[model samples]
Target: MKHALIFRVVLGLILSSCLSSCGMAFRSEWKKAPVTSGVEGKWQGTWLSDENGHHGELRCVVAAPISRKLAVQKFFYHATWKTILSGSYEAMHTVQKQKDGTYTFKGEHKMPDWAGGLYHYEGTIKGDEFKANYKCAMDHGTYVMKRVR
Candidate 1:
């Protein structure tokens, strides 16, 4: 009886120690941080190739009233038109920021069908700018943005 009692106590101690040291919690945030009032202004910057072969500029502004579900972005892009079939152009989209610091924005070009399907976005914030980035699966290109104001 004493051997059984001693075995049970030792087993309990070992299990308790292991659980206490595990210290693991569940974390689920889409992004990383929050936006400040000053960083919430228009951002104007360029998109250049890492190889210096191509470049374009973007001018974007956030509004006074930011909705919980949507923000706005306007883009004027000028590409070589090899496959684009056009020259310089203007476009718009509504963006959303998740509490976890992740963001989502959809362009308006494909409205009822795509609804910004091409622009589901993600970005990070630097010193004075919201460094937004979006990935293009078709072109295999990534856009980097900085806050202008």
Candidate 2:
């Protein structure tokens, strides 16, 4: 009887624990922020840095035409700060909106070692500019984002 009681108690405890987290499942509804404002639209801008003198143009779209959480983007540039300097560098990136109004931009490129890899941005969208904390696998950079599009 005691063994049976213990088994039932354990099973109940397990069931309760599982049920408690079922409510915590990640749903966009539970996203960190809502009200899609600022940071959405055609954006034409430049990337500048002190680490190395490089200039680049970026075009980005938020709340893309066909999908949610997808950012359509294109960037073309001359990176004099790169380890190897030569022709203009270009790459396409996709941005995905997180519930918190922040975004994740990723692409394949041969630029600064610190500029590649999974990049994450925490954005403050105000007016035509977006200020974000840009993070890469090996480095962190501050972006003074401007909107031109």
Best-fitting candidate, measured by lDDT?
A: 2
Q: Each prediction's TM-score against the native?
A: 0.39, 0.37
Q: lDDT for each of the candidates?
A: 0.41, 0.44
lDDT for each residue of candidate 1 in 12-41, tens digit (9 for 90 to 100)? 434533553321210111021224443345
RMSD of 1: 23.2
Best by TM-score: 1
Model 2 ranges with Cα > 4 A deviation: 1-37, 64-115
**Model 2: per-residue lDDT, tens digit, 21-132?**
4223222212332234454554445455433334444333344233444564543322222332222333455656568656555554543332344555554555666654
- What is the Cα-based TM-score of model 1? 0.39
